[model samples]
Target: MTTKTIREIALAWKSDKQRYVKQSTYAAYVLILENHLLPSFGDYDSLSEKLVQEFVLQKLENGLSVKTVKDILIVLKMVMKFGVKNEWMNYCEWDIKYPTSETNKDLEVLTIAHHKKILDFIKENFTFRNLGIYISLTTGLRIGEICGLKWSDIDVCNETITVRRTIERIYMVEGDCKHTELVINTPKTKNSCREIPMNKELLAMVKPLKKVVNNEFYVLTNEEKPTEPRTYRNYYHRLMKRLEIPRLKYHGLRHSFATRCIESNCDYKTVSVLLGHANITTTLNLYVHPNMEQKKRCITKMLKSLRK
Candidate 1:
């Protein structure tokens, strides 16, 4: 059977998307195809479900996390779908069953006391990163979005922040050596490009910080360049160590903000837009997790309805 190389077809597919899709998205598709997909499937027949299933199972057996495997499958599925639509190939009936992720009961959520302690630590330390921590906790901005923020996107009088871009790091493929570089690009989706109203305290803090920061550069980067995501992670780690607080992923700030918003009785759609999620359902699934207080409130509301 005559078959085209997966690399060639994937490039063709990427080029086709570049014609109509967002540049950042098209770039992501090309990167994932080159770095992850083609490396695994380039030599195989594009129509082989057996190879795809074996690859999925092998990934699971090799202890690749379920989320990672699911993401990979998503990319592969896109390429295959594109192939079918363009008549480059036709292979229906292919399926990838990703195993369930084990429940992590100990997933960290900051209590009010813990949140206060961290905030107080930041206040007393007077570090350059204080505003970042404050804004993230108050606003639920994704790390990339926060890092991408600039003074120009902020409106002091209006008390709002416009989320128009994201800071990302990509490994640049040079002739012989690969090096990572920080880049600023538009937000990941149309839904992610949004505006969020700021609370009073955040407004007071950011207004002054904006004055001191370079007007043309990102808010978080001290050198007027895009902030490396890993550097921010390290800074958070150091902050945790100094405060004697338990370590959580830098992304935990985003989750903590969302969880706090729900507990404080903020609306789901509001929280969804604040977090720049593409859909309210995604926000509900991820951030509307019920704590004991929330569960108790639900029960009370249900029981009260019975009185009628």
Candidate 2:
């Protein structure tokens, strides 16, 4: 029986997996293997549940979030599974546990006033870059999706915007060298490939610009060369500073949009589809936190129903 080190198995697994996944997905797997998994377990000739659980605890103690740790574990498991299939390692099920008192922080979202303030300011001082901010607030496009958007995706006749692709920067590590490159790919999920109807205001704002821009030009830059998300995020940071608004993550725009939809009594499923969530439960868990006023109304309605 030949024993293989974790690093050997992982390298073999990556070679096999790369052909089956998207470039972005492959990049992420490589990053996790290099940065997290390989450094910790590369030379180990055998893997055990206890070792993996300790790794989980150590990652959490070092300030990595639960989600990130779990993602690492998932990659580890994939490599382990690949090893088992090739008779290079044994298989063992893991039942990892975290502190029972663990709590997730509330998601950040903009208040209605701040949300409106940003929108009004953007409309008043509109530029091609500023328009991306507006589109994110009105439609629930992620920053990557917004950056990848082209003028051709907008339809003036139908008053809709089609979400087809997304752009992201991925890091690559070669022999003693690390570099990064921008990639444009299909949306994160199949559901993200749908069309969103533009309200009259959004249509009116973008219609004239669409006529003058080349179809293949990106919306944010109005040029053939697209602006990447990092640059756009920096622009957002500066915009917030100028507006005297508190700093929120670029993703908060999507959250703010979903929150506004829920506040407006939009159906949960509709909101899920708009945000391109894979499941309705995800939408509910993230954006369905009822405020005190809503709770009070719910109680009152329950009492009223009982009395009737």
Candidate 3:
């Protein structure tokens, strides 16, 4: 086998991997490699399942969420495979285990009252940022996707908003240089590049603006330059505070949208597609919680159908 440390192989792997991935994705891999994997295992030439398992537990103890730890492992596995393919290292199969926590957080969403309050407030007050939040409340657009939107993507004629790209600030480590850049890249998955039909409220607001705004300019800024997610998130937080609304992460807007849809009895597959989820199961897992009232009604309906 070629004698290359994991660090060397990882550098080469990410460099080659960049051409095939979006800039944001490559940045994520690099950040995880440098911040976690390389520091821990860079000099090692071989990876054993036990060593990785230990690393997993250490990460968990250090406060990384199970999902985050799993994502890090995924990148680690890919790099190991690359090194193995090139004969630089040997791969041991991983059967890593994660501890199940009873405190798994339920999904957070705006209460129905808060949801109505924000929508009503935004309906009366108009700002580009508010418009973006309005879009999220009415349709389950992720923060990056909403920030990436341009006037051109607003199809008032068809009453749909087509998602094509997303904007974010990404950390990139090149050689010895470490820096961050604001990047605009296509949505994370093919399913994310989708068309969501605008509801009446959204259509009304967008229709007039589409006629006057520069098609190539971003919607949030109404300029060629874009507002990144962090900045927009701050704006959202301040708006929530001003309205005396309890804090919710910007992402909660998307969750609220999805929750409202499911509560309205929108089909699971349709909600999945609109949210750009890779699978309907993800949508179900996040939002298919049946309340006790619904449970009672379901039981009643089921029994009614079998009446003797």
Can you rank all candidates by TM-score, best first? 2, 3, 1
RMSD of 1: 2.9
Give the TM-score comparing model 3 with the true structure, all chains together.
0.95
Model 2, span 118-188: residue lDDT tens: 98998899899999999999999999999999999999999999999999999887657889999999999
Order of candidates by lDDT, top first? 2, 3, 1
Q: Estimate each model's TM-score.
A: 0.86, 0.96, 0.95
In candidate 2, stretches whose alpha carbon ends up further than 4 angstroms from where it belongs are 306-308
Maximum-TM-score candidate:
2
Which residue pairs show backbone clashes in model 1? none
lDDT of 2 at 110: 95
- Cα-based lDDT for every prediction: 0.76, 0.92, 0.92
Model 1 residue 83 lDDT score: 72
* Cα RMSD, each candidate: 2.9, 1.5, 1.6
Higher-lDDT candidate among 2 and 3?
2
Assess the local accuracy of residue 165 in candidate 2 as a C-alpha lDDT between 0 and 100: 98
Looking at model 3, report the run of 10 residues with the lowest lDDT sum. Answer: 97-106
Count of steric clashes across candidates, in order: 0, 0, 0
Candidate 1 on 1-308: residue-level lDDT in tens? 33566666776777677798755565566666666788898765474777888887887788777777778778788777777666766665776666656664454678788887887666566655666777778777778887888878888878898988887776654335756667777888888898888888667666787767776777776556767677887887887787777888878888888888887889999888888888899988786667797789899999999999
